[model samples]
Target: MEFNNNIPIYIQVIEKIKQEIVTGKLKPGEKMPSSRDYGNNLGINFNTVARVYKEMEMEELLFTRRGLGTFVTESEDRIGQLRYEMAKKQIENFIFNMKQIGYTKKDMIKFIETENYLEGDE
Candidate 1:
């Protein structure tokens, strides 16, 4: 929950919530905390929490009940799509970095196949 100075706080908060949803830390149809409570918990403005919820709703990652509060989306297809979208962005970044370091597509594939990446290399 530490804020990155380089990134806007609301964007970081949005990313964190998205990650939680994608990872099942926030279950589908689970009620989200009230904006006031969430803002208090994060030490952010309530308006910021409201903005986050609004953006998420527009993205279909969340939906609000008439008076029951906001909940995570119950669509498995959307969740799967989110997972793929997140992974694809990561892979794009990895490839871009690798290319900048003089790596080829073949080299990247070979590195992946050879490295025991599943085991923590620490």
Candidate 2:
């Protein structure tokens, strides 16, 4: 709920929801809080929460039932895909940062192997 001046609030909300889903805090098929309530809890505008929910629905991460509420998607495959995508993004960011610091692919590989090999040597 803390908004960063550097990033769009709606995007931050979307990420929070995705993290909850990936962490099992928000289980599949669980009903999400109504936009109004969530906004109040976060001290943000209802419209912003509505935008977050709508964008998530578009991503197939959530679905809304008529006269009911939005719920997390019930597809295990979708959840797995989300996890993979998130991990891939994290790895990509790590690689980019390492490259920015003048690390080559060879250096990264060597570092990984050295650190992991010693730990597993026993």
Candidate 3:
């Protein structure tokens, strides 16, 4: 995990884990690595990883089962909400860039519905 100097490392780690969760890379109820182990693997301080776990727990994204370790929360609604938020952000950025280059709303919609756009994406 490469840390960006401009952003807080803990926040970056949280975003990465959130992306993993929303993308289904980390399934609901999946067990996560122990803070110490994860810190060692990432070569960061264990306390920082512990902070991440605590923040996640506070957000109800993860739950700790005492000695059993922490596991991802089984929240389908949360996952759906996250997916929606991510898609909305991407679409907003795409629209902003398109409009900057003189594309109208209709043009954007037409392009999105056309085979040319699909082929360009491919």
Candidate 4:
């Protein structure tokens, strides 16, 4: 995963894990890559990945066992709800920015529709 320079590395790592869950690349109850393994894969420090995992654990997105390693939480619906909330916040921010730029609601809707169509074409 390419880390963005603008965000903290840990945040980027969290986002990568979240995206994996949201996209079904990582399923509920699935084992996640270990900090060392993920660090090696991404060419990052193991501690960074560990920190991200720790944060996610605090958020209840994952659970860990003493010797079993970290796994995605068993609550798939909870994860989906979290992703939905995150997407809603992003959409709200986008709408706010669009309004600031003088875009009407209709214009924003049309733009979104067009973008969705183009994305489907991909």
Tell me, by TM-score, which candidate is best: 1
Per-prediction TM-score to the true structure, in the order listed = 0.93, 0.90, 0.79, 0.85
lDDT of 3 by residue, 1-122 (tens): 99999998889888889899998999999999999998998889999999999999998888999989999889999778877887899899999999999999999989888746677565
Worst 10 residues of 1 by lDDT: 113-122
lDDT of 4 by residue, 1-122 (tens): 77789999999888888888888888999998899999999999999989988999999998999899999989978898878978998989999999999999999989988778567565
lDDT for every model? 0.93, 0.93, 0.90, 0.89
How would you encode candidate 2's per-residue C-alpha lDDT over 10-53 as one tens digit per residue?
99999999999998999999999999999999999999999999
- TM-score-best of 2 and 4: 2
Could you tell which candidate, 1 or 2, scores higher by TM-score? 1
Clashes of each: 0, 0, 0, 0
Q: What is the lDDT of residue 113 in candidate 2?
A: 84
Arrange candidates by lDDT, highest first: which order?
1, 2, 3, 4
Model 2 TM: 0.90
